[model samples]
Target: MGRNTRKRSKTTGGKVMAAAAALTLGAGGLVVVNVYASAHESSGGNAVKRSSQGSSQGGTGQAAASEASTIDCPDVGNGLRQVPDQARAEVDKQLALLDTQISEAYQRLRSSTRALQQDGNFANNAIMGPLKDKRVATIDRIATAMGRAGDRPQGLESLAACTLRASGNQSDTGGNQSDTGDDQNGGQAGNGPVAADFVDITTVQPNVTAPRMSQEASRGTFATQCGVNENKLYNSDNVIVAPGVDNGAHHTHDYIGNQANDAFASNDDFAAGETSCQNQGDKSSYYWPVLRLQDGTEEFDAQQQGGGAEGNTGRILTASEVTLEYVGNPGGKVVAMPKFLRIITGDAKAFTNGTANANAAWSCTGFEDRQLTDKYPVCPEGSSLVRTSKFQSCWDGQNIDSANHRSHVAFADPATGACPGGFKAIPQLVQRLVYDVDAPSLNDNGRSSPFYAVDGFPEQMHKPITDHGDFVNVFDEQLMNEMVQCINTGRQCQ
Candidate 1:
């Protein structure tokens, strides 16, 4: 698919990435009518249903127009200024229908790939083309229903345009993010050998280090019941916006355990969220950057303008599988974690800094000994590719939020995986990510082939070893206590 840059407002400060676009879309504006259709379908009936409540404000305009919103479109806001209740209802119904139709089409397309080329053509015309028109029409109806008609353009494009113009930040695009952070750096130049330049991981096996701590090196272990989080579900607003910014991660994130991922979500929210963990009492919420393929296809395609998920500029897809494992103190001694504590493991900017920041674990099925650094393995037909993230397990006795994220907690010793002398030992959390993709080869034509890289990630990611992990501890007090107990006593609890 062609890549389209999204129209973004400079006022948001953060660069316009796929995640940010998703945040904008999720914040309000255009509703994703077709994204969740399959999730709400009735097995015995053809009728589609809505899953979330209406808008939260209980008023009209874009505020009350989201698929998961609870607010009702009010009769106010003058004509064309706000979405009406009746129109909102109608648009929502159509969106649900669109979801069902598109999902069915995708399912059919997935049944075979014998004619990859022919199938691709059919997907574009028979599926994508019609879906695009329906989406555009749905946006138009929203504008017309709100009385915006000619005043506002089709899709949320109109809403975004107005927002940018009103903010007067259109000309204020001077603040480009500095390259110091991992998000900006593409890897240090002339530092070490580029992991990608190597052939397969096996060739460089001796150079790579497997990120594993033997039981003898640790006090205990915290194991997770579910090795992979495969359910097609996501909720962005559940988490808080970035530290100073109003919107959280700016993109939609797949969340498991605690459903309430929003910043404003409290310990109570964690307690109340539905969990997929074997232990229902474990209400810890795990999250990470949603992985997208180079072509912009994600596990759940939102079909928004651009590609991938809604608001994304490329075709991005969710990882084939995300393994949620509880990081237990491999030493068998566990310390309690402070409430609301947050930590990011593996550097998101590793691609820019090189191996020093790249401590993630990676391997492909069948080829075990050949560890990987920056290179991805091109597996044979029946192999599995996987990525693992091990979080820092040592924490300072005090403080949850810190100026330097790493300062609050530190990694255990590599030799023993033991907490430092004064630091507290907490359950280490690791996210083992698996994808159904392999390394790209030179023989592919037209588009990049075999090796599927993440959309928007740096070039290093294209090589495969750039895989890193990110995390936040949104576990409630009760869950943390249980983890501490299990780790401290050397008990292996799933």
Candidate 2:
């Protein structure tokens, strides 16, 4: 697939009334229509409006309103089982467009406060109705493209109509969150990481469990030293998911390992890219959403499309430490991963898509055993914040990529510690990121201590469940074979 250079521009603040319309004829003469409109700001100059019906401690009315106010649409990409090579590009493009539509609709919902307060049917009529129409059209294009080459997907229209669902930021009854905050607008961007999105680490019970290993388990570990993105390489392009589309990820990503990775990078480009690791033979690319401190600081991309313009504002936080280790599978002997293999662990839209594919694990440095998947941990005074991602360790032994970008890989079974039928055990990439920022002060809604959030799609609300990571294997063949041998032979090697 070919890609174009990234085109970025700063979006102005306040009410934006721009409407863009484009019509193009794709391969096989399919008509592709794209329409986008910015949301109107509140007349009172407030970016966000909090419900006044709640108390400081436990207010059901306000809490219900806050929790129930978010857009929920079925994930069309997950429903796809097979996409022909001829239609894969078009399908991926349409999928990315679906994500953009949802983000825009969510933005409209957030900005139109007065309309929502004045009219009961304003959201359904103005926001959701139009969003559904756009989605239906995009979904149809996907079906048509696939039908031309292979069998068309069924029941895609059922995924078009979205509904208002909970934002997954509701405060736990026993969690520490006080509504008596001075900052009313949800974070610095007026979108997310609300007071209810965090919990004290000390209160969470230990939940980490190890899978039972058998006698045939591969018991070695190969640790690769990739710096914590010290050079600050970042981009919003997702080559694995959206491929040729620029800004496919509505949020920025911190990149390490393969320096030549971008939307336009080809397989040949990655093979020839510069390396950040001390071992030049390993050139695999590792990236994830950049963590940010919502403290009113404007970084370089603050006003750009994937940054503040998309409700991802504040100062980008670089991980104090990043560990990339390929460990042996608990199931059996390991195999070398094919070059250019891609894997996406967690769901970036899990806040609305549900937690079926969510794999984010959060904890404090000392309390690593107690991991939190849905809520950010308020670490103690000295402990640092940690984000860990354990990638799928079982491969189909055939394709490097899949139609949904996930069907090609699977995680080993937890109970039996066995790979699925016809699948082979492979080295599991365990990524760990540590940050030294102070915990947010939920009592004051992060007024004194700013709330930190992982950058995500605007509609995802920056919820911790939406945290995810991306990896592309670009290791030299010799180095990859060595990694596989070390893991299978039970030898710890770097």
Candidate 3:
């Protein structure tokens, strides 16, 4: 479900603060996980699940920024703003590394799981625990890097690019996007007041009117649909998503942290999955219902298709907009996000398969592509541009070749594709972006990466289910070689 765009935590926005709180077990990790779990269960049994497929986002400028990425910026009227080309490049580099490391850890986990199975160590959990430790360490490294890099924390900036169209980008109707061409520079190129209000909170809103806890702002269709906005959700706030949630945790003005939020994020409890797997002799929590729909031919619904039809919550991942409370109230401006997309579950064959070449569970679903793609300028079909399978794969398990692409990114069907026999499928929500700006022409990619997703726990790297630092480490090492060669030749930034 992680594309260029991701949740700051789990909420769709420009800030990339996503970490599943799975790494290194930060100080507050347990509290958050418990809370998130409660929220998941509370979401109820019947909410219409939708496609996690996201629509096209805004454009990244023809050229990348130089060093402007490190510059400190503030929260706009809400939390959305333009990122310098330098910042985008750095973030992309960081994401690349985190992606790689996590994949590596996952690979190790695979090996450990197998080792455990063969050595009769599953019951002892010795292999699993050690592998989990390694994974957590890797996640910690990613979190540390995020803190060091100082971008929209988490690997979320990419999600924002996917969600919030920078300025000057266009959106399909009802898709919440704009193309005004005005940016931080106050008029594009991020030339204006770059520093905006920034929000950093660890708990749900104590009170709506309590300073950062609450403020006043306009709410529209996008806000109602996505469940957050400049007034509530932020261009840079961390949201949480858990496997199970409890309704008892719901609180007043608690929209941001309560378990009740499960309704909006398209998460469906696996009651059926629990029942089915209960008799299979597998782990109790491993049951997944959406996967049951994999065999149903209703997988491909161009409009309102094959997601689990639970509650009547009808929201599209195609596009949406929400304004967070920008303390300065900078002219009461709103941030526009395009194409919100996310998966209900990350467990898939792609994870089971070490590299991309291994038989994927549903590489055709863009699921693997979403997890393994490199930089942009995808294939002719757009999505393929990020694929690496066109090259070759290696079994060394140490070095990962870029060309080892996922499936046919060029011909993916709608989120509604019927699963082939024996394939596992999960629910996903998709939506487009739309913008309601003060001026019609003021709502496009002001200056940022549409392919970037903002992390929810910008400060807490543990928020992302998968470590984002893995992406950065790999990217830096890869590009650094090129950079070192350029530096030796007296080249600054190519």
For residue 417, model 3's alpha carbon misses the true position, in angstroms, by 39
The residue-by-residue lDDT of candidate 3 on 307-381, one tens digit each, is 211100111111133221101111122221111211112211111111222211111112232322111111112
Summarize candidate 2's per-residue lDDT along 1-494 as a digit string, tens digits: 12346332111111111121222111222111111111121112222223343223222232323334567677888777567777777787899999889888887877765565555446655777688799989999988988888666666777786655445333222333323211233666766777677889999999888877778888888999989998889988888888777789999999999997777677877888898988999888999999999888999898787899888989999999999999887768888999888999999987656566789899999999999887899999999999999999889998787777787899988776588899888899999999999987667423357889999998777888889999999999999999989988899999
TM-scores of the candidates in the order shown = 0.51, 0.84, 0.20
lDDT of candidate 2 at residue 167, scale 0 to 100? 51
**Model 1 agreement with the true structure over 201-259: per-residue lDDT tens digits:** 44445544544656543344566553244554443321321331212232344556555
User: 307 in model 3: Cα distance from truth in Å?
Assistant: 18
lDDT (0 to 1) per candidate:
0.41, 0.75, 0.20
The TM-score of candidate 2 is 0.84
Where model 1 places Cα greater than 4 Å from the true spot, the runs are: 1-199, 206-219, 226-231, 235-252, 263-268, 295-321, 327-332, 353-356, 443-451, 455-466, 474-482
Q: Which candidate is the best by lDDT?
A: 2
Q: For model 2, what is the alpha-carbon lDDT of residue 485?
A: 93
Model 2 segments more than 4 A misplaced: 1-67, 168-185, 444-447
Backbone collisions counted per model: 52, 0, 154
| Higher-ranked by TM-score: 1 or 3 | 1
Better of 1 and 3 by lDDT: 1
Model 1 residue 241 lDDT?
19
